[model samples]
Target: MIAIVSAPTNLGLRPPQPGAVPGTAKAPEALREAGLHARLLGEGATDAGAILPGRYVDHPNRSRNAVRNHEAIVDHARRLAARLVTLTREGRAPLVLGGDCSLLIAAGLASRVARPSGLVHVDGHTDFRHPSNSPEIGALAGEDLAAAVGLHLPEIADIDGLGPYFDRAATAHIGCRRDDEHLDELADTIGLVLPADRVVMHGAARAAADVLELPALDRGFWLQIDVDVMDPQYMPAVDSPDVGGLSPDELIRLLGLLAPRAWGASVTVFDPDLDPTGRHARTIAEIVATGLRDLGRDLAL
Candidate 1:
C-alpha cells in the first residue's frame, strides 16, 4: 500500500520577509484540499496523518554558523523517520507531502533504517550549498542535498550517529539547470548528475532508465521531487522558481517512470500562498497523483 505522510515544516527556509513566515509549511493541507487525499484514498491508499513540526522562526541576527530552527528541524526529522519506519514495516510505501526540501533529511534517515538506500533527487537547483562551497550558510532547504550526503555541519548531518544518510555513490541528481553553481561539485560527488538540458536531450524515459542502472537500485531507492523542477512558467509557486526548467509534461513522464520503483518518495517546495487561485495546487495534485498512482506495485496494493 502507498501511505500518505505529511511533514509540514518550513523550518529550513529563510523568511521571505522580516516578520512573516514561509507559506510552504501549509503545503500538505493545501494539496489535500485540492483533492489529492480523496483521489489517493479512492485508489485504496491509506492516510498516515501528519508529522507536525515546531514553529518557524527566522533569527535574522543569529549567526550563520548553524541552520535556523536547528533543534526543531532535527526533532522533526527524527519523528518523521520513525513514522516512515513504521509505515515501511507495514509494507507501505510512503508518499510524503513536504513543506520544503529540508524534509529530505527525514527521508534520508528513514531510508537507512532497513538497509543502505539510494536517492534520486529531482530539483531545479542543486540545493548543494555547504560551508566549503559558500561562506554564507543558514537555510537548510537550499542545502539539503549537501546535508543528506554529509557535506554540511555535523549537527544535523550526523543525527543519531547516522550521518551521510545516502552514500555519495548511491545518489543521483537530476533536473538542475546549467547555471547552478554547484554542478561541478555535484558531478564529482553524486553517482549521476543529469542537468535539465541533458535530461531533455536523453528524454525523461531514458533519464529514468539511466538511474535504474545505479547499483543502489539493487537494494532500493528514495525519490525526492521538488516541484520547482518544472519551468517557472509552469510552476512559479515555489520558494525559488528558476527560469529554465522542465515542462509539466516532462516532469510527469519522468516521475511516472521513476515513482513505482522507488521505495518511497517526497514531494516538496510548493507554496500555496503564491497560488491563491488554487490552480497550482490542482496542477501539483494531478502531477503527483497521476505520476505516483502505481507506487509500491511490488506489494500489489
Candidate 2:
C-alpha cells in the first residue's frame, strides 16, 4: 500500500513580492484535481493534511524568513516525520506531495527514525547552500541538502538533536544543472552526483542504475524529485527554472528504475500558479502515478 501525504508549507520560498500569490501551497490540491489520487488507487491513500507556514519575516543578522520561521519549520517537520514514521513502520510506502523543497528536512528526519537511510535527490539545482557562504539566505528550500547532511543551518540540521539525517557516503544527487552555485562543493559532500549533462549523455536508465549502485542500497533510501528537474520546456511551473533538464519521458524512465528501491518519495517545488493551463499539473500526476505503480509492484514482491 502507498500512502499519499500532503505537506503544504511555503515558508521556504523567498517571501512573495507585494502582490504575488503563493502557488506551491496549492500544489497538493491541484495534483488531486488532475487525478493523481484516483489513478493511484485511493483505497490506500492517507491524507496527512497540509502544514500551513507562518508569514515570512526578515532578520538583520540571519537569513530572511530562515530565522523567523525556524521554529515553525521545525514544528512542521516533527509532525510530518511522525506521520511518515507510522506509515513506514506499517510497511506502507509514502508518496509525499509538497509545497516546496523544505519538506526534505521532514522526510529525511522521518527516514532516520526507521533506520539509517540514503537519499536520491533529483532536482535542477544542487540546493546545498551554507549560510556562511551564501550571500543571501532567505529561503530554507535552497539549503535543504546542506541541512540534511548537517553541513550548516544548525536549527534545521539539529532536528530532535539528530543531525546529519543521511550519511554523506550514502546519498546520491541526480539531474542537477552543472552550473549550479557551488556545484563542486555539493558534489564533494553528496559524493554521488549525476549532473544534467551526464544524465543526458548516459541516458536516464543508466543514470538510475549508477545511483542504485551507490553505497547504502541495503539501508533503504528516499527518492526525491523537484519537478523543475524536468526541462523548463516541459515543466515551467517552478520558482527557479534552469535551462537544461531532463525531459518528462526521461524523468519517468528514471523514476521507474528508482521507485522499487525507494522506501518513500516526494515531488516538490511545482508551482501550479505559474501553469495557468494546468498542463504541468496533469504531467506531474502522470509521472507520480507511473512511479508509484512500480513502487507498489516492488513492495508486493
Candidate 3:
C-alpha cells in the first residue's frame, strides 16, 4: 500500500539566476496526467487501495516568505512531520512527493519513530550543509540534510518524536554527487556514501545494502529519492542541477530495487519541480508505478 503525499510548494526561493529553468509547481496534476492512477497503485482503484487522502503540504518557507517569519517553515515542518507519521500508520507506505529537498526534514523526522531503520537517501546534493556553510547565501534547499541530521537548524532538531533526529552513523546514502561544504560534512557524519556511477553499477537492491551496509534491519529502512538525483539533461526542471547525476533507468532500477519490503519504509522523491518537459516527470511517475508493480509481483499479488 503506497500512499502518495503531494508536497508542492516552491516556498518561493529567489531565483538561482535569471534564465535558469524553473522547477514546476505542478506535480499532482502531472502525476495524474502520467496515468499513474490508471495503473500502478494508490488512489481511486489502483491495486494498492488509497489508504489516506491526498494532502497538500503547500506550506510557506519563512526564509523565503520573510526571514523574520522563519517560524513558518519550522511550524510547517512540525505539522508535516506529524502528518507523515499519520499517513504511515494508516498502512500505506508513505511516498512523499515534493517541490524541494526540504521534504527530507519531515520524512527524516518521521523516520525516528521507526528507529533502527536504515535511511537510504538518493540524491545529487548532500543536503547536509550547515547554516554557517550557507553564509546566508542561496536557498535553504542544500541545508536541509544537515538540519535533519542534528546540524545548526533548530526548527527541525527540536522535534520531540525525532530527538537526535537519526543515528548519524547508521544513516546510509546512495546516488550522491556534486558535493558542497554542506554535503561534505553530511557524508562524513552519515558515513555512508555512494557516488552515482557506482550506484548504477551495483544495482539498487545490492547497492542499497552495500552503501547503507544494511544487515539485520534490511527490512527496516527509509527509501528516499531526490529528483535532482537524475541527470539534468534527462530532467531539466529543478532548483539545482549538477553536471553528472543518475539516469532515469538508474532511478527506475533503484525504485524497483527498493520497493519490495517494509520494516517501516518511507519513500520520498523530491524536487519533482525540476522535472521539465514532463519527460522526466512522466519517467519518474512511471518508475514509481513500475516499482510498485514489481513490489506487488514480488509479494505474490
Candidate 4:
C-alpha cells in the first residue's frame, strides 16, 4: 500500500527576503487542500499525517560552511528518518510530500536502515553544488544531491555514520536541462543520466525503459521528483523554475512508468507563494494522483 507522509519543511532553503520564511513549508497542506489526500485515499492510500519542522530563521551572516537552520534540520531529518524506517518495515511504500528537496536526507537515511537502496533523481537542475564545486554553498535544498552522494560536509552527509546513502553506480539522474552549469560534473558522477532533451526526443516510455535497465533497479530505488522539472510555463511555483523543461503530460507519464518500481518517492520544491491562483496546486495534485497511483507496489524484493 502507499503511505502519504508529509515532511513540511522549508529549512533547506534560503529565505526569499532578509526576514521572510519560505512559503514551501505550506506545500503539504496546500496540496491537501487541492484534494490530493482525498483522491489518493479513495485509491487505497493511507495518510501518515505530517512531520513538522523547526521555525525558519534567516541568517544571512552565517559562515558559508554552515547551513541555515543546521541543528533544526538535523533534528527534523532524524525524526523523519525514524518514521520512514517504521513505515517501510510495515511494508508500506511511502510518498513523502515535501517542503523542499532537503527531505531527501531523511529518505536516504531511512532507506539505508531499511535495506540497500538506490536513488532516481528527476529534477530540472542537477542540484550538485557542494563544498568541492562551489564556495557559495549553504542551503541544503540546492545542495541535496551532493550531500546524498556523500560529497558535502561530514555532518550533513554522514549523519548517523551512514553516509553516501545511494551509490553513484546505483543512482539515476534524469530531466536536467542542457544549460545547467553542473551538467558536466554530474555526467561524470552519476551512473545513468538522461537530460530533458534526451527524454523529450526519445519519449517517456523509452526513457523509462532506459532507467529500468539500470543496475539500480535490480535492488529497487527511491524516486525523487522535483516539480520544477516541468517548464515554468507549466509549473513556475518552485523555488527555481527553469525554461526548456518537460511538459506536464510527459512528467506524469514518466512517473506513471517509474513509480511502480520505486520502494518510496518524494515530491518536492513546489512553492505555493508563487502560485496565487491555486491552479498549480490542483495540477500537481492530479499529477500525484495519476502518476504515483501504484507507488510501492513493485519493489524488487
Candidate 5:
C-alpha cells in the first residue's frame, strides 16, 4: 500500500518578497490533479493536508525566516513523524509531497521512529550549510542536511530528542551542483556525494547504483528528490534552478532504480505558481508516477 501525504509549508523557502504567490504550497493538489494518486493505485491515499507556515520575516542577524517559524517547524515535524509512523505501521509506503526541502527534518525523524534508515538526497544544492558559516540563517531548507547530521541548530538537529537523524555513513547525496563556496568542505563531511559533474560523467544510473552500495541501504533508505535536481529547461518550477541537471527521462530512470529500494520517499521544492501553464506540474506528476509504478512492480504492491 502507498499513502500520499501533503506537507505544504513554505517556511523553508522563505521567499524574499512577502505575499509572493504560494505555488509550492499548492504542489500537492497540483500533482494530484495530474493523476499522481491514481497512478500509484495502492491501499489508499491520505491528504495530510497543508501545514500553514508563519509569515516570512527578515532578521539582520539571522536567516530570513528560520527564527520566526522555529517552533512551528519543529512542532510540525513531530506531527508529520507521527503520521509517517502510523502509515508505516499500517504497512503502507508513505509518499510525501512537499512545500520545500525543509521537510527532510520530519522525514528523518519519521525514519528513526519507524526503523533504522538511510537517505538518498537528490538535489541541485547540497543543502548542507551550517548556521555558523553565516550569521543570517535565512531558511531551514538550505540547512536541512547540516541539521540532520547535528552540525548546527539544535532545534532541528535534535528533533524528537534524537540528534544526527541519519548516520553520516548511511547517507548518500547525489545530483548536487557545484556552486556553493563551501561545497568542497561540505562534501568532505558527507558520506557519499555523486555531484552533478560526476552524474554527467557516469550517467544517473551509474551514479544511483553507487549510492545504493552505501551500508545504510542494508535497512532500506528514504529517497529525497528535489525537482531542482532536474535541468531547469526540463523542470523550471523550483525554488532554486541550477544549470546542467538531469533530463526528466534520466531522472525517471534513476528513480526507477532507487525507488524499489526506498523505504519511503518525498518529492520537494516544485513550485506550481512558477509553472502557470501547468506543463511543469504535469511533467512532475509523470516523473513521480513512473517512479512509483516501477516501485510498485518491485514491491508487488
Candidate 6:
C-alpha cells in the first residue's frame, strides 16, 4: 500500500519563487482517479497546514531577516517526520506531493526510520545552493537540498535527530543545467553528478541506469522529479525553466525505468500557478499517472 502526503506549503521559500498551484494540487486526485488510494497529510479536500505551512518567505535566505524560520521548519518537519515514520513502519511507501521543494526534508528524514535510502534527483536546478551564494538568499526551497545534506542554517542542520538524514554520498542528482551555476559546487560535494547533457543525450532511462551502475545504486531509492525538468513550452508553470530540458517522452521513459526501483518516490512541481494554460498541469498529471501505474506492478515503499 502507498500512503500519499500532500504538503501544500510554500512558506519554506524566499521571494521570487514558484510553487505548486494553490488549491490545485491535483496530482493526488489524479492518482486516486487512476485507482490509487492516496491520503493528504492534513485534509484531502483542500490545502491546509498543520503538518503543512502556507506559502511565504518567513525564513531569511541566510542572515538577511529578523528570525530565521527555525521554529516553523522544525515544527513542520517534526510533524511530517512522525507521519512518515508511521508509514515506513507499516511497510508502505509515501508518495509525497508538495507545495514546494522544501518538502524534501520530510522525505529525507522519514526514509531514515527504516533502512538507509538513496535519492534520485530529477530536476533542472540542482536545488543545492547555500543561503550565501544563492541567487536569492531569502528562500528555503532553494536551500532545501543543502539543508537535507547537512548544510543550511543551524536550525535545519541541527534538526535534533535528523541531522545525518541526508547521506551526500548516497544521493544521485540528475538533469542539472548550466543556469544553475550555484548548484555545481554542491553537486560535486555529493556523489556523482549527472549533468543535463547526460539526461538529454542518454535520456533519463540510460542516465538513471548509469546512476544505478554506481556503488550506491542498490540501496533503497527515493526519487525526486522536479517538473521543470520538462520544457517550458510544454510545461510553462514551473518556478524556473531551463532553456534545454528533457521532453515529455523522455520523462515518461525515465519514470517507467525508475518505478521498478523506487522505495519511495516523491515529486514536486513548484510554481504550478505560473502555468498559464493548465497545459503543463494536464501534461504533468498524465505522465505522473502513467509512472505510478508502472510502479504498481512492483513499487515497494
Best by TM-score: 4
How good is model 6 by TM-score?
Answer: 0.82
Question: Judged by lDDT against the true structure, how good is candidate 5?
Answer: 0.77
- Candidate 3 vs 4: which has more lDDT: 4
Where is the poorest 10-residue window by lDDT in model 2? Answer: 292-301
- Per-candidate Cα lDDT values, in order, are 0.90, 0.81, 0.56, 0.90, 0.77, 0.64
Better of 4 and 5 by lDDT: 4
C-alpha RMSD in Å of predicted model 4 compared with the true structure: 1.0
- Per-residue lDDT of model 4, residues 232-274, tens digit only: 9999898888888899899999999999889999999889898
TM-score of 3: 0.77
lDDT, candidate 2, at 30: 92
Please state the error at residue 193 of candidate 1 in Å.
0.6
Give candidate 5 misplaced runs (Cα > 4 Å).
19-22, 42-68, 294-301
lDDT of model 4, residue 40: 92
Winner on lDDT (3 vs 5): 5
Identify the superior model by TM-score, candidate 1 or candidate 2: 1
User: Which of the predicted structures, 2 or 4, would earn the higher lDDT when compared with the native?
Assistant: 4
* Model 4 clashing residue pairs (backbone): none
* Model 3: lowest-lDDT 10 consecutive positions: 45-54
Model 1 reaches what TM-score against the true structure? 0.97
- The regions of model 4 sitting more than 4 angstroms off are none
lDDT of 2 at 174: 90
Tell how far residue 252 is off in model 3, in angstroms. Answer: 1.2
lDDT of model 1, residue 35: 100
Residue 223, candidate 5: C-alpha displacement in angstroms = 0.9
Clashes (N, CA, C under 3 Å) per candidate: 0, 0, 4, 0, 5, 11
